[model samples]
Each structure stands twice: as structure tokens, then as C-alpha cells.
Target: MTPRPGVREYVRLIALGRPPVGWRTTDVTTWSLARLAGRLIDRLVVPRMSRGTLRRILREGKVS
Candidate 1:
């Protein structure tokens, strides 16, 4: 199955440290500092995640 669009775009944008032209933001949802921080945590702190596991965490992270 294909990956979630935003999540895949997010990973690429982060790896590049800037969004490509096609990834331009709109009025409804602009990328922000907090979002970058969250992505960093997702990439660095979260364990290697399969699509199913990632979706689970996206829904509710490590509930304890």
C-alpha cells in the first residue's frame, strides 16, 4: 500500500530542511516550529516503525 501523503512529504521535507516547490503551504495549515520538533522526535526518538505501528502511534502514542 502507499504511504500517507503528509507523512511521506514530512519526512522528505525534513531530510532536505526545506519544502520543495510543490509542497507549498496554504492558509489553512502552515508548517510551524512545533511541527518540526515533532517530526524530529518522530524520526529520532520513535523506534523503527512499520506502517501499522506508526499509524497506531499517530492515533495514540505509547499510552501508559
Candidate 2:
């Protein structure tokens, strides 16, 4: 099982000079660290992501 690339990972990729894949500029612009943390909690509780997706993100260090 892997985890999906969450908001923080997406943001990190962008910060690393990578282009946006499935995310919008507003999505990154509007997110604060606090909001990202909250969303992480939500994902943990709600289980919206599959483990494979997250594993890919971890292994690749970017969203594909």
C-alpha cells in the first residue's frame, strides 16, 4: 500500500521548480502550512488516498 501525494508534497515539488501536474495555481497559493497540516489529518481520518499513489510519490519524490 502506498500513499497519495498530498498538498504538501505537491507544494514541495513546485517549490523545487517542477511544473504543476494536476494541481491549480490557486490550490498552491491558497494553502498555508496550517491548512496543509489540517488536510493531512483529514486524509488520515478519511483515507481518501490509496497507498500505491503515496508510495509512488515517495519513491519518485514528485507527483506524476
Residue 62, model 2: Cα distance from true site in angstroms: 8.2
TM per candidate = 0.27, 0.29
Alpha-carbon shift of residue 27 in model 1 (angstroms): 35
| Model 1 misplaced regions, further than 4 Å | 18-47, 50-64
List residue ranges in candidate 2 displaced over 4 A. Answer: 1-47, 62-64
Per-residue CA lDDT of model 2 for 34-53, tens digit only, reads 44334445546334544444
Over 1-64, each residue of candidate 1 has an lDDT whose tens digit, in order, gives: 3345565454444544543344433432433444534554555743343545444434342221
Which of the numbered candidates is closest to the native, going by highest TM-score? 2
Give per-residue lDDT, candidate 2, residue 44: 63
Model 2: how far is 15 from its true place, Å? 17
Count the clashes in each prediction. Answer: 0, 6
